[model samples]
Target: MTITRRFPATLLALTLATPWSAWADRVYSDAQLHYVNFVQETDGMDALFRAMDEGNIHDVAIMGLGVAKKWEESAPKAPRYYMGDEAPVYYYSATDALLADAILERPAAQQARLHPFIAGFNPTDMNAVNHIRLMLDMHPGLWKGIGEILTRHDDLTALTKGETARANHPALMKVYELAAAENLPVILHSNITSKRERAPIYLEELVEAVGKNPDTTFIWAHAGTSAEIHRYQERVSGLHDIVSTLLAEHDNLYIDLSWTVLEPYLLDEGEPDEEWVALVKAYPGRFMIGSDLVGRFDSLASTIRSFDAFLNALPEDVADGVARTNMLALLPE
Candidate 1:
C-alpha cells in the first residue's frame, strides 16, 4: 500500500509567521538537521552561526568564497539584463584559506560542524587543479569535498567570460580522480539545457564524468535548475525521468534537492506528487536536501520550511536520510 503524508494547514500558517523562532521551534526543535548547501561569504559568518543556532542546523557543507569580482566585471552582462532593477550581482570569495579563516573566527561552541567544498569556476585548467591540491595540503583537515563546480552553468558562464567547461572535461576528470583517491565526493551544477525547452541536452557530459570515474561520488546540485532559472523557464517534465534513469544506472550519483528548483515536480497543489514520491522511495538513499542559501543567513529557516511537505511524504527512514544522514555519510571522517 502506498502511504501519503501532507503538511498540516496550521503548521503552514505558523511557518509563514514572523520572528522565525516560533516556526523553528515547531518544525526543527527535535529534528536532527544538517544543511548541505551553505555558500560561504567574506562577511556574515557570525550571523550565519546565529541563524543556525536558532534553527538547530548543526552541520553545513559550506561552498567556497563566492565573490569573484574580477570575473564578474569582465564577463558579459546580457544574461542578467533581463533580471530587472533589483537583480543583484552575486559574488564569491571561495578559497580554502578564507573558508578556514571564517570557520576559525566562530567561537568553538557556536561553530556548526563544517564540511567545505572547494569551489572552482574553470576546472579545465591544470592550475585550478593544482590550486585545489595545494589547498588540501595547506588546510590538512578542513575540506570535505570538491565543488559546486559551475559546470555547464549558463548564467555563470556568461558572467565569467563564457568559460563553458563541461562536467567530463579533462581537467575536471583529473580533479575527480584526485577526489576519488582522497575518498571525497564532488558536487557539480550542470544544467540540463541552455534553452527554455524541457530537454536533457548536455546530460551526456555529466553521465560520462560519472561513468568514467565510478569511484568518486557526485552530488547533482539543485537537480540542474535554480530558483532564477525556474522563474524564467517552463517546468521540464522530463527532469524526473532523467533523474530516475541516472539513479538506476549510476551507483555513485546523488541528487541535491535545493531551493525551489524541483518544487513543482515534487509537489502538486502543496501536496507530494505520487510519481515523485515513488521515485524517491525507489532510490531512498540517493537524495538529500540543501538550502542553497548564498550567504543569506535570514533565509535558512524559510528554505528548510519550503521542503517540509516533500520530506514528510517520504518513507520515515528515507526522510531521515535526506534530512541528515546521507550528507553526514558523505563528509570526511
Candidate 2:
C-alpha cells in the first residue's frame, strides 16, 4: 500500500495522470457523460440504489439527498415518502433511518427507499439539535410515551462538541478522528445562504480545530458559486483560502462544484477566475466532481451539458481536475 516516490511532486503527478481528451480545445463529448449524474431530488432512491447495486452508476458520490427527498415527498402518491420533510438532517437521512427503512421495506413497497447516508445538516442545526437532544437525553425518532428509539443502529454522533452539552463549540477534531478511523471522507457544505456568513465559525474554525488528521478528508461544497462575476472580480478577488482550503487540507479532502456548476457569472476571459484553474493545477487530486440541483437520470445530460459549458470555459488545467481525476482518487478500489 506504500505510494512510491515516482511522483515528482504531488501536484505535477496528478496533472499528468488525467486523461488527454479532457484537455482538448473543443468541449468534451457528450460521451464523457458516462461519468456524471445530474441528481436533482431523492424520489428515485430505490431505483438509484438498485442502479448502483446493478453497476449503472459507479462514478457519482452519495451527495444529493435533498433532491431525492423533495422529489419523493412531492411526487404523486409516492409510496414511501417521509411526511412533510422538516429535519435539520446532515447530508441524507441518517444511518439509522436508512437501515430502518431497508429492514422494514416490503419487496414491492416504496417504504424501502432512502436518501444519502450523511444528512448535510446545518452546522447551526447540528449544534442546536445536539443541545436539545442532550437536554432531552434523547436520540432522533424518540417516541413520546414509550421512550423508544426507532432504529436498532448505534448512534455514531454520540460525542458532543465540548465537555458540556450547551458549550458553544464545534466537534471538528472529533469529526476528523472519526473520519480517519472510518476511512470516510468529510464534506462541509459551506458557501451557505450568504457569502459573508462564510467565516471563522463554520469550517475554517473546524479545519483549524481539526488541524491535521492525515486520513480525514474535508470538502467545501459550492465554492461560493453565488459569488457572481463582479464579487469575484471587483470585490472578494483575493480569497485563496476559498481555494487554498481546497488545496491545503488533508489528502482525502475534496471540493465538489455542485451548485456552482450552474452559475452564469464570468470574467473578461470568460473564466470564473484565473485562480480556479490555478487551484486545480495546484491540487488536482483532492477534488470530487459533481453537479448538484438536478432532477432525474434522464435530466442529467442537460446538467452535464451545463457543467461542461462552465468547465470548457475554464483553462484546461483547472477544469480537468474538477471534471474528473480529483474524485477518481477517492474511488474505494
Candidate 3:
C-alpha cells in the first residue's frame, strides 16, 4: 500500500534538540485528516481496541514502522534503491526547523498530536531518486505554507555516504541501537519489491545484522518475501552466515501480512486460510500483526478489511496469536 504519489512540503532542516526531533510538521494539508487522533476517535488505541471488541483479532500491541508527515512530493518517480530515498525533508537544515521547534514552540497537546508511535521509518516504494526528486521539485506549487517554512530554514543534503549501502545501513543501526537500549522490540523492516532486482539481497544483509544483536527483538517484514526464500536457497544454500543474535533466526523473526501487493502474488489465495494459519503457528511468539497502513493512499476501511480477510483465513488459534498474543508479547506490560 505504499502509494507512490505525494504532495510537497518544507525541505528545510531544523537544528533538532533531539535526533528524533530533527524536523517535524503536519503530514496532511488539513491536520484533522490524518490518523493522529486515534484516542479521540474511538476512546483508546482505536484500531486495536476495535479489533479486540469485535473478535476480529486482539491481544497484539501495534507499533507503526514508518511515520513521516507527508511525501516530499509524488511525481510518480521512485528511488533506484528503495531504501536510499527517505522523504526529502528528513535530511538536515537548521533555520526553518519546526516540529522540534514547534513542539518546544507550541503547546503540549498540539505536539503530541504530531508524533507517530513507532521509532523506525520505512519507505517501501522503489525508484527513489526521481520518485523523491520530482516531489521535492514540486513542493513550491502544492504546499506553499511548507514552502515558506523551507524558505526561512536551512537546506541540508545527505551527510551519510553511499545512501544505499552505508547510509541506510547506518541509519537503521542507529535506530535499532536505541530501541534495543530501551528494550523495545525492533521491527526490522523486510519491505520487499519483486521488480527491484538487488533490493531484497541488500536489505537481507541489514536484517541479518539485527538478528546478530541479542538485545534487539527482530520482526522480518512480509515473511521475508519470496525473493528472500528463493535467494536464501539459491545463493547461500540457506546458511544465513552474516552473524545473527537470535538462535532460531527464521522462527524467532516475525513478518506481518501487510506490505504485500496482492493476495495471490504473496502466498496462496485459494487455501489462504489454512496456509496463513499454519504460517502464523509456525512463527510462535515472534509473529505480530502490522498494517503498514498507507492512509494518504488507501481507504482505512479497505486496509482494515484486508486485515479482516487475513484473519478470517487463519485457524482460530493462529488468528488469536497474530491478532493478540504475539503483539502483546512484543509490547511492554
Q: State each model's C-alpha RMSD to the native.
A: 9.5, 11.9, 15.4
TM per candidate comes to 0.80, 0.51, 0.47
Worst 10 residues of 3 by lDDT: 145-154
Candidate 2, residue 261: Cα displacement in angstroms equals 6.1
The lDDT of each candidate is 0.66, 0.37, 0.34
lDDT of 2 by residue, 50-97 (tens): 443342223344332311222344445532222223321222323323
Candidate 1 vs candidate 2, lDDT winner: 1
Steric clashes per prediction? 10, 14, 21
What tens-digit string does per-residue lDDT give for candidate 3 at 1-333?
111112112211121111211224101111011222111111223442343334332212222212222233663563322233454433222211221232234343332222222322222223322322333243222111110000001011121222332213544555445545545554443333223343344445545555556565555544434333344332222222221223245434544444342244223553344434554555544554544432222343344345545555665555545544454344422
TM-score between candidate 2 and the true structure: 0.51
* Stretch of 10 with least lDDT, candidate 1: 29-38
Could you give candidate 1's per-residue lDDT for residues 19-65 as a string of tens digits? Answer: 32333342232111122222223336777677766666656777653
lDDT of 3: 0.34
TM value for model 1: 0.80
Question: Which scores better on lDDT, 1 or 3?
Answer: 1
